[model samples]
Target: MEFTPVTHVLFDMDGLILNTENLYTVAFQNIVSKYGKDYTFELKLKLMGSQTHETANTIVKELDLPMTPEEFIIESKKQFELLFPDTEVLPGAKRLIEHLHNKNFPIGLATSSSEESYHLKIDKHHQALFSLFPYKTFGSSDPNVKRGKPYPDIFLVAANKFPENPKPEQCLVFEDAVNGVKAAKAAGMQVVMVPDQRLDKRMTTDATLVLNSLEDFKPEIFGLPPFDD
Candidate 1:
């Protein structure tokens, strides 16, 4: 396969760079179980990479829960506060980010998380690693974004923030959700997906490339600087 050299790198935060998906599962399960329902992988696949309100509404409707989206958000925020403080950086995330940063690649974060929850995930354990990004676009809170994954708004907004305002094709996105890959592709960028093990293989078709983990990424394949072993 031929690869084009990309000038900018964009990342999806939740399941991609951070291990917050496990915490999210615990939180969602705690909520749904209270209503005698289990949070299943089918629902997770649909909700991944969606904005906060979108996720809340989907969960409430899909599970036939009694609570409104507002109430669900309130309850989930409580669980997140308790669990997200323990968010761990995923494998190869730091090493790759550092390698790219050291090589002077323009890196940015485009996440479906709201500003409030974004801080909850990163404020304690990941401040330094995330600080590598010169800018981060929070889809749930950023008015300019207007939409989340499966829409190109967030990725387009992030690409515009770069000093040079790179074109969409000049950006290389790293994502871990079907919706995220869709969003990046819609924005006309190439995306590398590192999907969850439970996700259906067929769902990853839109991604320019798919890998099992960030540890398996080869920057040179995308025309980025190679890591010095």
Candidate 2:
């Protein structure tokens, strides 16, 4: 698809940049399994890109668990600290980010993770990569973000944080969740989705481009400088 003259880019963290989604799956399964509940992929899709409270509430309600949202949060946080720091950068993620940053593109992170969570997940392993982002909209706790993905709050906030305050049409978003695609569209931005193979193909129509991994991305297609091989 032809893209606009995009000048800014925003990224989603969990499954998009880092491999922490798998860690989350393991943690959720371990916790819910204690209550004889199974954490299914369908349920995981529904919670993707959601805030901490929303995720916890959905888990407790959907699985008929005995735990409260607070309980889930506390339990999950413990598992996260033990697992998140060990996550690896997903394929092509580091290359793409470094390329864009080296080219002086305006890029930021827009994630449902709070500042505390972001640090817990990334600081030990990927601080250099994150340092490239001048702006970050942490939806889980950023007060300026009154809502989360599928609501346009986080993406809009990220776009607005650019020093030039880029127009929505001039921004592009990289995401790995269905809700994230919806949010980017709602915010009037182009989205490139690198979704899980298990995700339904029908759900990807909203994305301007859908690729198996960041390695498959073509910068020139989005009006960005082509990567030199």
Candidate 3:
């Protein structure tokens, strides 16, 4: 599909910019292991881009874990505390963000992470990197975001936060989850999906483009400034 030149960029946090997806996978594995259940890739994909409550319930129902959502949350919290503090930035993520920042592009973060969870996900090592984005919509807790990904609420809210309030068509979103791609499309924006290798390519066919990693993204194709060679 063809797309117009984009003036604004919105990025998803977990799997797109950071290696939190791996961390999350480990946490989920640690949780399910206690019950002798495997937190398979398919299950991880379903939980990807989901909100806190949504993830808990999905885990309980899908895994048949004998625990309430709240209990799941409590158990998961233990693992999160240990794993989330030292996440690595995805390859090329810093370069891309810095390129956009230097060009003075209107950029923002539209993530499913709640405010509290956001802190855990962005430790001091990552705080400086993320601060480059002037606006961020933490969907799990933002009042203006009535719905999370797979809906347009967070994307719309992030887009509107730009000083120029660019139209949805003028926004380009970078995501690593199917629900996030759907959310951007629902908001009338073009999306580039850099999904997990375990996720089938067919699952991301709806995206404007799909790549194995952020390192493979080509800025000029989307009308953004290309990186220094």
Cα lDDT tens digits, model 3, 1-229, are: 5667999999999988988988888898888898999998888877777788888888999989988999998988888888888888999899899999998988999999988888888865799899999999998888898876788899999999999989999999999999999989999999999988878778998799888778888888888988878
- List per-candidate RMSD values in Å: 0.8, 0.9, 1.4
User: What does candidate 1's lDDT look like per residue over 1-229, in tens digits?
Assistant: 7778999999999989999988899999999999899999888888888999999999999899999999999999999999998889899899999999999999999999999999999898889988899989999999998877899999999999999999999999999999999999999999999999988799899989999989999999989999999
Clashes of each: 0, 0, 0
Please, what's the RMSD in Å of model 1?
0.8
Candidate lDDT scores, in order, read 0.93, 0.91, 0.89
- List TM-score per model, in order: 0.98, 0.98, 0.95
Deviation of model 3 at 216, angstroms = 2.5
- Model 3 gets an lDDT of 0.89
**Candidate 1 lDDT score at position 166:** 96
**Model 3 stretches with alpha carbons more than 4 Å out:** none
